[model samples]
Target: MSFNHPTTVLVIGGGAAGIMAAITAAREGAAATILEKNERIGRKILATGNGRCNLTNTDLHLKHYHGQNPKFAYTALTEFNYQNTIDFFANLGIMPKTETGGKVFPFSGQASSVLDVLRFEMEQRKIIVICQADINKIKKTDNNFYATCKDGRKFQANRLILAAGGKASPNLGSNGSGFSLAQSLGHHIIEPFPALVRLQLAESFLKQVQGFKFEGTAEIIVDNKAKARATGEILFTANGISGPPILQLSRKAGEYLQKQLKVWLKLSLINHLSTEQLEQILLKRWHNQPSQSLAFSFTGFIHKRIIPAMLKAAGIEDINKKVSNLSSKEIKQIASILQDWRFQVTGTDSWSAAQVTAGGVAVNEVNPQTLESKKVKGLYLAGEILDIDGDCGGYNLQWAWSSGYIAGKNAAFV
Candidate 1:
């Protein structure tokens, strides 16, 4: 059968990374074509940062990223650091605003604005963009590669860049199709799991606590040992727990939960106070208001909506009993509960709710400097499809920018 003639480069997947790669290639004088399986390009990108798109973190460190080889990101990150990302966007006409914690959002705080700029850039560069095209086959010949879509359309290129994202947001068009493509091309893939997803618990009381939001610290313990911890806003849901703190712990939670290990969360409703310190602080309050009931005394320490639940958890015999009547041991128990309330994690909310996928193409198979495949020449990988995943905030987005930039620059050179 006759096939399409080879072009300079063929970049598959039109999400964040794919678009960036395509734009980079075209700007370097290479004819680039992007084949997207979705109806529109960058659908997943428009859903990022709660629709505002936290494009990159101004302050990024190696600690923020999680992977089998954490150091694998060192080269790409340095080559296209946060400042480079800021400059890239600033040149694209999208003014980014730094919010609390170095999280950068578009000045309009709309994810669409970021997408629009990328779209405009790709258009100006005159890159060929075809949507609603699903890649069915990829074959490497002696000198180049051939990609055939399910629609029987064939594309040939000297270099291929796979920016098809991970399986996290299938509704946004990343449904593990990229993994299938990579495996077909002889790549070893790490088992993909949901990351940055809300957790589900077996506790029955969560139904009553659903919809309640609290500011607290959550410590993730594996087999009763403290493995990791984070402090942020926690939200109780009908099914389980969510919010920033829970999402921060989800990457580890998802991994350990798969091993059938006991994953527990020690939630501190109060921040930075040790159990002993809390006990002493509460004792002072009790002595200062001897006639006030313990329930009345704790109103200032906790949210009014959760005070009754806190009292119940502490096993206070009388809500109306004066604090002065409470024994020393009883007051300490209340402080302990506030300082170290714990919950068990049963599972995650699933890929639909996951912000980023945990695992993808193993980093060892791809060169970090250029994001090129070690097993195959003229092939590259980037974005969430790689095994690298970052913590909450703008870490994941930063990876997208860095990896995309490297892949694009290298693909054009090839």
Candidate 2:
């Protein structure tokens, strides 16, 4: 298949970055085309933020982003900041509402809403989107880039922007094929790993507390030292623990696990109170209900189902013993266990379960300012295909928008 007009910019991957890049390129008066491997464009976008589509974050600090050189995102983020993202979407008739942690979502609260507006914009700009067009090879010859698809269809363009995402959520479209495509074209790729994923633990009692959730702080302990920590609602799984806080710290834990280092998860059930404070509270409760069974004494304090497991893990052999029989030393032990519950982290879930990839094409090989390849002129890179990965929330999507804008603008001019 061939286009009637010459394609000025050919964008690979029809994800958040690719869509934005194609739109941005077309907006700059360049004929743009997007070749999506999936049957439909924006399949991944539809899954973001539990279908609500967190567009961007108001608090887009440098610290939230991670990579070999996180500063590489400085230029793109500054050029297309959160306000720019809001304005860009506003033009497409999207009103955004900011939630806690500065997570910005569409007023419609539907990921489909974001995709619909983007599709409308693409139609208005006459951008060509060819879904199920999986390119098998990309070659630059005679000042033009030629992309040959698996079906033997060939496409030629003046410039190419690779926005194919990382390996995370293969079902949603990204399968790390972009890395090989970039590597074939003289770019170095960083080893990719699962990020923002659930972790597996070595504890057998996890099955008992499976599905139990509580608001607490989860800390990543590596080599007997605290490496990272986050506070949020944590849910116990049959295999391990999960939730926002665990996801936040998974990157560090995954890295440590990759290196075969000792890794542990320290959970604080009652983050609001110190260990001493918790001990006093337990003592007071025990005194008020001295006749209450040790297991039943914590009925109102925490989930009844988890109390027995907690008591057992705390070395309490007889959970049926009366609170009056509980010694002061045992009370302190319970308090310490509640505040410093440790679990050996075995590993993280597979790439399919991860929200984003931790590594990709190395940033040093690409120009951060214009999102262009340093080795191949007129070749640009964008989105999670690069090494940059942001924290949970809307930060990753924001990176997509920013990098796509920069790459699209430069690809159009080239």
Candidate 3:
């Protein structure tokens, strides 16, 4: 039942990073092999950008990336860059198109197209890919690295690239097992947490406004101070709020919640209007329909489902009361609530619901220039397996391509 296959470079985890690493190594004239735990490679890539597969972003600034040592990503990001990503895919027959927020996708607008091209390139290069390869142990001795699977199968290589992803979206293949693999080789882990996920709030009226969607700004307030903010579409779930803006703030909220600090999400439902402007608008509307019930007053303003919950939260208990009876103070309170609807953040959704992982193998333990592990010679780490996780909108995949190329190029020579 045991077999030993030798290659010049062996890559674990056939996700975005692993696939790129193997391909890059093969292009460097080194025989490369990929070990994937799933039935097929790039399973997670299918879920990116809601299946459009954001390849990379036009905006490649350092501000979008997050990690213990985010600067560690500087070298790889600059070396490969977004232009390199577009060109790389262009050469692979993938026509790149730029969308809003500098997000890039294939011209076909299909994630399957992206995977198809990557698979085609791997096939053309004759790269070996072993699916369902649950590597349980990895060790290096002399100049060769050995990886053993749970089924007693073995693989050997001169250089090993641990491109296995972090602990997010286990169904798509990553289960945080890469942390254990890297730790086995004396690497430090930064304690992975769910990122790009929904935040569960402690508010009791969430179900009342569930399914309500709007364009607004979301801010994460930790210990009474605003930590991070994002403005985009926001969604209300049965137990919490979500959508792009909320997901962007989930990382900081989760981190603060891990410390048991008080976390709150302040949502600016009417972000376009100033507080004074909102108050004046409400007054004008009430003046036009002075006899209208408070509940029906906002019929044309916001979602009807949210009106009751929002009014209750703003301290307006008598929704049946007429608008004429409302004092000036009550109108200002409603305006303030519309501008800043605060909800206590209990925690974030589980990893299965997360789009990416917040932390991973510490980047400092690996050389930024080459992505080679300082603890183990010839051991390269890339992708979500490293601590580098980027903001939504193709940044994470860009990191994958950048680090994978660097790791693969360096490992090929090693």
Candidate 4:
């Protein structure tokens, strides 16, 4: 049932941040209410970590995040950091296991478990939750705020926290509507773009390297200057590239594309060996396999599916050419192909494919310590709706948890 009385703390959006905010307020003995648009809460949380839910990471530094003002994260994170998050979940009866790179997941290995904990906490705290209430407009009064739903449900509160997420994973309910809501309330909305998404390359390069999964570095260069670089497993799809490394830099690639600038992908497919060491290895291999065909010589080292494309890119048409006939220059040419492969990034995948959205309300406008708006009083902001986007790890979720806690804690005390 909808909340019939005045809400002391009204938190919008039922995802990670909103729920946490409501919980914090209710636990502090405030009348807290959450208005969620989805059929239920935590739809996006269920999709995190491929259903395992990477809750938080141990390796958190300013380098792992990007925005107009990355320093804003320091205050919120300092107030409630990684260990606090681990303890927060632990108190909820969840035992978390850490994987490589400090990614923490529940021992149960289900996102539903995390969501259930959140549900259980809300029930315990007696926080009023109204689902399927699509917020249409938010208005501010001299004393309080009023959130009007499209279904004619109006909620009044002394304080309002807008945790509506960014324009990513629209199927999961973040359709960028939060931007408009903030803009309507006399707040500036920064231009939003797709982040942590796959990149579509030039058709020719994709056709040659489709389905090639390898470990290496992917660099996004704009106007001949390197913008961002990441190292991880990069997988090529039929049309583009996905995987941690590519998705890490795709946001910058998309931003540069919109500026009508040249963006190129410089890849180092094999990272372990130096260029000289790779050339030396190639020289010895060519000498040792003098009688084998060019195609046969690469059989042991490279996959059969990728050899043709690699050979073709190296300008070697004669796959059957005997190794003895291959010159030192030809071997070096093949080695260079592996070390330095470049492709022009045409664009990034749309919001439907992106994991997060880059750019939102400017960080400087929000008080990082309290997550309250500097311009709009009693209106706190959290989650992906802000001008903050973290890397592929658990940084985003950490921001949601920390910011939600701060906003919730203060929204009640205010």
Candidate that scores best on TM-score: 3
Candidate 2 similarity to native, TM-score: 0.96
For each of the candidates, the C-alpha root-mean-square deviation to the true structure, in angstroms, is 3.1, 2.4, 3.0, 2.8
* Top candidate (lDDT): 2
Q: How high is each candidate's TM-score?
A: 0.92, 0.96, 0.97, 0.94
lDDT of each: 0.87, 0.92, 0.91, 0.87
Query: Compared with the true structure, what per-residue lDDT tens digits does model 3 show for residues 173-284?
Result: 8888899999999998988889999999888878877999999999998778889999999999998989999888888888888788999899888999888888889999
Q: Any idea what lDDT model 2 has?
A: 0.92
Query: What's the candidate order when arranged by decreasing TM-score?
Result: 3, 2, 4, 1
lDDT, candidate 2, 92-186, per-residue tens: 99999999999999999999999999999999999999989988899999889999999999999999999999999998888888999999999
Estimate the lDDT of model 3.
0.91
For every model shown, the clashing-pair count is 0, 0, 0, 0
Candidate 3 weakest ten by summed lDDT: 1-10
lDDT of 1 by residue, 1-414 (tens): 112332488889998888888888777777889999999999988888889999899778898998889799989899999999989999998898999999998898989989889989888988899998899899999868999999899988889999899999788887999999999999989899999989998776777778888888898988789888888889989899999989999999988886778898888898787777878888888888899987889877777667766777778868778988997777767888887777788899988899999888999999988899999999999899999999988898888888888888888864
Candidate 4 residues 86-144, lDDT tens each?
99999998899999988999999999999999999999988888999999899998979
In model 3, what are the clashing residue pairs, if there are any? none
